[model samples]
Target: MPGESELATLLRDLKPMLAEEEHGFVTIPIGSGWPQGLVPVATFAETEGASVIALSSILDGIGLEYEEGWAKITIGATSALSAVGLTAKIAAALAETGISANIVAAYHHDHVFVPWARRDEAMAVLENLSKVQE
Candidate 1:
């Protein structure tokens, strides 16, 4: 199915759901495999590093030092890459409340990573945004 592109529809219907796990982001050498039993929610290759986002426990278990307390918000819209303003809308809402958002757009959905301590507040902002008719 074609992804949604209309900004209004994207906001109104995009249910932002938070993943239950408390996550963290880390970077290790690209050639090394992830420590056993740890699954990353996302991973990326950078020129200087390989980045992984995974559960805090996994980071601790693996003996890799990492930044702690990140949370993911999965937007329930198959949004087209060309879709405009959705990130801005969500970011703006959070910004107004002094919360920062890190957004990742995948083929199937847009995920927002926020400070773990603020996940519930971020969800409330997104939920309220979804309730807006226009």
Candidate 2:
């Protein structure tokens, strides 16, 4: 299947789906062993630490204190890695309402992380954005 590249198509077809599992971003030192079954959706290397996404249960199971309570919004658009403005458009819409977005762009889909408490509102905003094309 072909991936979407146009900004308009990406926006109109975003079809954001909120994941049922609550997630969090946590940091561990570079040399720390990765816990079993703790599959990070993404990781980043920083000068001070290594960032990862671990399910809340995994964190608790491993006895690791984590920055907790973020929700995932998987934008259901097969957007090209080079697609532009999709992130900006979504971010801007959420920002206008004082919501914050942390985005993870993968090969097949873009996942957005929003404050756990605001997941419902974020879903509403994204749903409206998609309907704009209808």
For residue 54, give model 1's deviation from the true position in Å. Answer: 1.1
lDDT of 1 by residue, 21-115 (tens): 88888887767766677688888899867888888878888777888688999999778888889999999999999988988888889999999
Compute the lDDT for candidate 2: 0.87
Candidate 2 regions exceeding 4 Å error are: none
Which pairs in model 1 have colliding backbones? none
lDDT of 2 at 106: 84
TM-score of each: 0.91, 0.92
Report lDDT per candidate. Answer: 0.87, 0.87
What's the true lDDT of residue 112 in model 2?
92
Question: In model 2, what lDDT does residue 134 have?
Answer: 65
